[model samples]
Target: MNTLRLAALEALLLTDPLQKVDAVNALHLELPVGAEQSIQDPGGIPGRPSHLEFVLPQKVPRRSVHTLQGRAALVHSLAHIEFNAINLALDIIWRYPNLSDRFYGGWLTVAKEEALHFSLLQAHLSTLGFNYGDFPCHDGLWEMAERTKDNLLARLALVPRTLEARGLDACPVVREKFAQAGDQQAAQILDVILRDEVGHVALGNYWYRRLCREQERCDFDTYQQLAKQHRAPRLRGPFNRPARLEAGFTERELQALEEQA
Candidate 1:
């Protein structure tokens, strides 16, 4: 299926939601790497679903899940995350073709899982009289993606290990909120996300350490250096230690996170 990176670029070039995901689904990473040195960085926002109006994170309102619109709002936010996640995966695949082969294939797996999460959330949103792009969202995630576009290791340190790992710590709290609101289905969906996210975060940890080793840098210290160098967001806690451990964070790393976040 063409060059794998180009297939990712095709996914990133299609603005429609389903079309973009279909392009991702069509990817075959085993194909020979084509003239990757010639990939042109696309302009405007990377292929995104139409009608997704993005606002600053502070501008997006928070709502409780006690009411129908409230529940839909919360779920819409998650769906938006998954959608951007698809773009992030695609962006990394094409933007850094110079990385190890496993890097590209690993991100393909992430893109597929993100598509599943988005599809699941889209279906759930429908039952609540909502669909994706039905509410305003934020660009914090992609902002970081754009910031780290030129640095693959920084992308690994911040996007996946830092931001995505934050999701692991948040899942239980969000699930409990859904459960309390009597939306068992939404709560169950968070469980599904939690399961898959562990692997995704694990991938980040694996790559982060591998890259550090390859560069002869200390893992924990290098993460700190990158976080400082890139202005990665400060972590906060009530950290889900078990989930973090399962996702491959070392105890010292966890302590560093706690100290700084």
Candidate 2:
């Protein structure tokens, strides 16, 4: 039977950006979760479009949002993040088996929402006279995914708790950039992304704590240990404190993050 996790794996392997988005949106969430299924690594895990120019993070040029092409490039960069987010969500669901059914469903839901975010950004980019692949991008998000692929705990800790959490801080800033650039539509899209991303990160925090309990570890200490072992990026501020709190970060975690800044 074609299970939900299996379906997500298929979607992850789709090379075309629009096709992958459509596949995720069309997924049968009502299907079996296949929690115990141990699907083989089919290679080409995250199929990429041929035209995408993957450049080093530092090599990707930053453009002023005030210019038309620059705004489009910024929008393209966001769309790329959403696209990778969809893949990250799908990868977690399929790669980790025997987890709680909620885990798979949670990530699948995230994948669908990420697809929506990508679609919104992609459509907005068109109005700016560009498409998703119109600009160079970095694979930093997926690089972290790769580093944590062998460990589900690390994946949750670094990818969602760490990487995606950074998005919470950046979204409002990016939204304002678009608003100041007179792109009200893009700004509105960011609002939607921010609202949904808070829940997604909360979900990660929930599961991370659950796993910590099962592993007989303190969540905070384990997070610090994992962060150091994984060499996760340092947290910076000004953080979106309210959003972080809404997303399930405790007061102490907020303090720790602030201390890190």
Candidate 3:
């Protein structure tokens, strides 16, 4: 039977935030098993709207949310992250093969949630007189995705665990900023994103451990190796221990993360 997943992945990579979200929402997530093979990487990178100007992380300007323009800038940045996340999840579903059907199923859920997040944030941006691509953004997230493109293990270890996990630590701080700025709705949107992220990170944590177990590798050691090999960004914290714990990180992992700082 033909899987709907590849078709859905293709749809996700098309341009325009609203239409892309609609495509994802239209997916039949359950009752479909992924095809084991028969796909080629896209000839070009995933589609993006023409207005988005990608720059180095250092080059992206930061603004205070005390002003309306500044608040919109912050929301635009969040929308960019969600946009890249949707691509990441879609990429994982199609790029990796020879795993349990559960793997594909799980990533599909991640993709759907990410699409929802992008839609939510994008809509909020509109209320603030901005759109997803109104400001320039850095390509750090997708850069890691490209680095991990050839190895599923590296992808799992770095993209989700190393990169996405940082969101767990960052959300609360951002939420408070939004609230202090008197943007209760913006803060609540962050609440939803943070809640969904815990589960996504948990899925990554689960599969990373699963893959390491099946490969007869030590989980902690393998993660370190992957981080070094991929030159992953150093994790910073003031971590949200409660969220990390909810996201399936053990105390041992938490300790290791702390020691990394």
Candidate 4:
């Protein structure tokens, strides 16, 4: 397919609901078979939109989930988030242009991994007799993506490193909650996501630092200013130091982040 179509596909994937597995599957056919299949086998083609929309809607059920139904609802909520995350990665690749091919490759790899994560989570949700979108979810993650759309630097700094890295920080806590709830399978799934997300955050760091270097700026301080300017969420600590370090965060940078907290 042409580049425009590829980009449109990525956008559609972002808005499409997770319950339509066949529609998801067709997205694969829009690209070269091998490359598209590598993008997690979403089943449909994407169409173009003449305009963009932003709505701060909350759909996930807020009521307590004390029974089996509640557990399933929560699982589906998480699955929906992962589903959006997959498209976010793809959009980064298709929407932005003129970067090094490595940038495109990096995001494509991320998109595939995110798709895998979403599929795994969806399968687990199904076993509990709940599918994605069976419960309501917040639009917070995608909202951040929309906010960062115009500036790749801001996108790299905020979405992956800030918002997505927050996932890395909270994974352990979520795992503990799952264990407490005796959902060993869900806890194990979270473990896999945590391991992979470290790499994702690191990829964001890689690009952010690259941009800083290319532009001849101090990466750490710039990140600080961007966070404040964007009103991005303030980071909390008890950080996963090892994961952050592996994700290309320098010791000095980590110190700076801690100072901000």
lDDT of each: 0.87, 0.93, 0.86, 0.71
lDDT of 1 by residue, 1-261 (tens): 468888788887788877777777778766765534568786865777667888888888887789888889999999989898888888888888676677888988999989888888988999989888899999889989988898889999999999999999999999999999999999999999999999999999999899889999998888888899989888899899999999999999889878876
> Model 3: residues >4 Å from true position, as ranges?
30-32
The root-mean-square deviation over C-alpha atoms between each candidate and the true structure, in angstroms, is: 1.6, 0.9, 1.4, 5.9
Q: Per-residue alpha-carbon lDDT of model 4 for 1-261, expressed as tens digits?
A: 344336435555544445333333444333432232223335532221213232344534554444688778767767766776776776676556567656766776676677778888889888988766565566677778777777889999999988888888788977787788889998999998988899899899989998999999899889988888788977888777888888888899788778878
**lDDT score, residue 145, model 2?**
96
1-261, model 3: which lDDT tens digit per residue?
556567666765688777777776766656465666667776566667877898888888888989998899889889999998988887887777777878888888888999989988988999888788889999899899989999999999999998899999999999999999999999999999999999999999999999999999999899989999999998877889998998888899899889877
Candidate 3 vs 4: which has more TM-score: 3
Task: Arrange candidates by TM-score, descending.
Answer: 2, 3, 1, 4
TM-score list, all predictions? 0.95, 0.98, 0.96, 0.79
Worst 10-residue lDDT window for candidate 3 reads: 29-38
Model 2: weakest 10-residue lDDT segment is 99-108
lDDT order, best first, reads 2, 1, 3, 4
* lDDT (Cα) of model 1: 0.87
lDDT pick, better of 2 and 3: 2
Displacement of the residue 38 alpha carbon in candidate 2, Å: 1.3
lDDT of 4 at 53: 32
